[model samples]
Target: MAASTQRRGRRIMMAPEELDTFLREARTCRVATVSADGTPHVGALWFVWDGTSLWLYSITRSKRWAQLRRDPRISVVVDDGEDYGELRGVELSGTVEFVGEAPRTGEPCPELDVPERLFPAKNFGLDDMPHDGRHAWMRLTPTAIASWDFRKLGGL
Candidate 1:
């Protein structure tokens, strides 16, 4: 007797509620990009979910920002907060066009005195600071996104 197998195309769309859960589940993402000299760089970042977009902060002096300065295109990987079971993930591929130090997104950039201002008071302290020239803040706007939650798949 032969056994049948099931294979189906999985769409990468996360429902509004699912997205909220995923975003809340994962607060960190790794930003990846290539430098002007063709060097690869990746940095872990804390992000905020605005329902329609993802926001994060970076110091202009950071290597990640240097690479992004030359290449606006980048990738971000955010994973589920759980340990072994039910791992969900969100992968974002988009351009990192610089909008200057303006607050166009109404999202606060990382600063020495204050965090994104979105998190609770206990989320950050006055220890964070830009290393080099003190860039103050940065913003990354997402153009494309891919996310998956395996809750329905028994943790695929």
Candidate 2:
């Protein structure tokens, strides 16, 4: 995971610990990918943050999957708060690496164990991951990150 290069709004920037907690508590992230035609596609996904990386479980047959196969570059944003003073968010950008089988059939991969355990427990309240054979994992060890919490501005 590369360090965040955020210079602007330093007062509002989230600390490393705060960023970790925010990502862990946030449920959805908007993923951005480049299409083969040079356009951009954005979609919402439920993701797990492992402190060092972000793991995305996506449908192998979806357009997002197809686009990623063609171009692995991606950017993801997880944000919260409706009010201006309460707003906070994190943005992670990097190329993603496909992990395990394309359509995961629960094949044993040690690299996936942590995320597999964390994802279900966080999202579904389950002890173990339920593999459907249609969804697979993509790991993004971000090259760049930017985060902010407006509350840190002291109500400014």
Q: Quote each prediction's TM-score.
A: 0.66, 0.97
Alpha-carbon runs more than 4 Å astray in model 2: none
- Give the Å error, residue 146, model 1: 1.1
Candidate 2 lDDT score relative to the true structure? 0.94
User: Compared with the true structure, what per-residue lDDT tens digits does model 1 show for residues 1-156?
Assistant: 011121231543455578667765566888888977777788898765555455666666678777776777888888864644466676777775554363233334333123344433323533333333344344445566666656655545
Worst 10 residues of 2 by lDDT: 1-10
For residue 9, model 2's alpha carbon misses the true position, in angstroms, by 1.4
Quantify all predictions' global Cα lDDT against the true fold: 0.58, 0.94
- Give the CA lDDT, 0 to 100, for residue 76 in model 1: 85
